[model samples]
Target: MAAGLVELAGVGLEVERPVRTRILHPIWLTIPEGARVSLVGPSGAGKTTLASIVGALQPASEGEYLFRGERVDLLDAKARAGFRADNVGFVFQNAHLIDERSALQNVALGIIDPTVEADEVTGRCLAALQQVGLAEVADRKAALLSGGERQRVAIARALVKGPRLVIADEPTGALDQTNGKAVLELLFSLDATLLLVTHDLAAAELADQVVTIVDGTLA
Candidate 1:
């Protein structure tokens, strides 16, 4: 078997504030390069938490996380942020775009490296928007876009940096059927490895493999 691009060994999470609560039970998973994996589960089943851990947005409270043979679970916050900037793209159910920003500007925010020149950022952002079929509205404020358009813009933002992995959490949950299908097609067409969390079986079916999470453990 090919080596995994991402691997989680006995990974889990817990919260200790109000009361010590286990948010995720230890689980193991592997995702090879260029593979598409879907995570399906009931609400509050820890799907999003697992996606966050894989995306480097949060650390696993136990066990190890390896990405491309590197130990990601050991990184500090700043280092983890850098790792994510270099390798991961994320899309959520909500577009989370700034209402006053133009589509191009919104996409440009995805480029986290401060050393990139302005013209290059602009060029890259425009290209990303073009890829999502939103070049015509590149300069339009985000508030004016339709629901589907907004989600497309979100996708463009996620793709602007040419990430190796894309983690989408309920990406099409709020869309109409047609719009949801379009979004799923767009996501599946990307060249990167995909880790998707969704409740839609049709969307999940598009993945190369589907895994179920129930009440914090893989089922």
Candidate 2:
């Protein structure tokens, strides 16, 4: 394959404690910039574990992780945190919004760069909300928004910082069919590379590539 924005070479994970469990078998994968890739697998098959590694939420037990051809697995914890803050945005099945906060406030919290001026942050956050079709509700409290609206706000939060990669773990798993499809559409419309972990085959079909994991290894 051609060089990609992110590359994993012989990456694997294991825990010495809890009786030496191997969660992910050595795997090689490449995610190109601006591409949408869906990861699907059975429950307990290590899909989230692998995605967590890719997102820098945790490190692999062994092997190489490269971002833009640079080794990331070797970065120290603080550096890894910085790397994640700059390059990655994540959305979980739960919107995880603060109900007491307005949509804009929640999205503003996603901006990790302290150097961003307050005005610029507001502009960026509003722009992101506009992108997700939630601009009208920018001032509405999250508690008052519908489920679909909350998810849209979550997406705006992810996009506010202009991340290079978006890792969405079952982003639509909590929505009904209509809302889920809308979320999927919004995700697919992003300019950034997307790694969507989903159980729905129909949702997976929206990606340029769909990968499956079975028994800790890519299938």
TM-score of each: 0.98, 0.98
lDDT of 2 at 189: 94
* Pairs of residues clashing in candidate 2: none
- Position 145, candidate 2: lDDT: 97
Instruction: Evaluate candidate 2 by giving its C-alpha RMSD to the native, one decimal.
Output: 0.9
Evaluate residue 139 in candidate 2 and report its C-alpha lDDT on the 0 to 100 scale: 93
- Alpha-carbon lDDT, every model: 0.95, 0.94
| Model 2 C-alpha lDDT versus the unseen true structure | 0.94
Where model 2 places Cα greater than 4 Å from the true spot, the runs are: none
Error of 1 at 139 (Å): 1.0
Give, for candidate 2, the lowest lDDT window spanning 10 residues.
1-10
Evaluated against the true structure, the overall lDDT of model 1 is 0.95
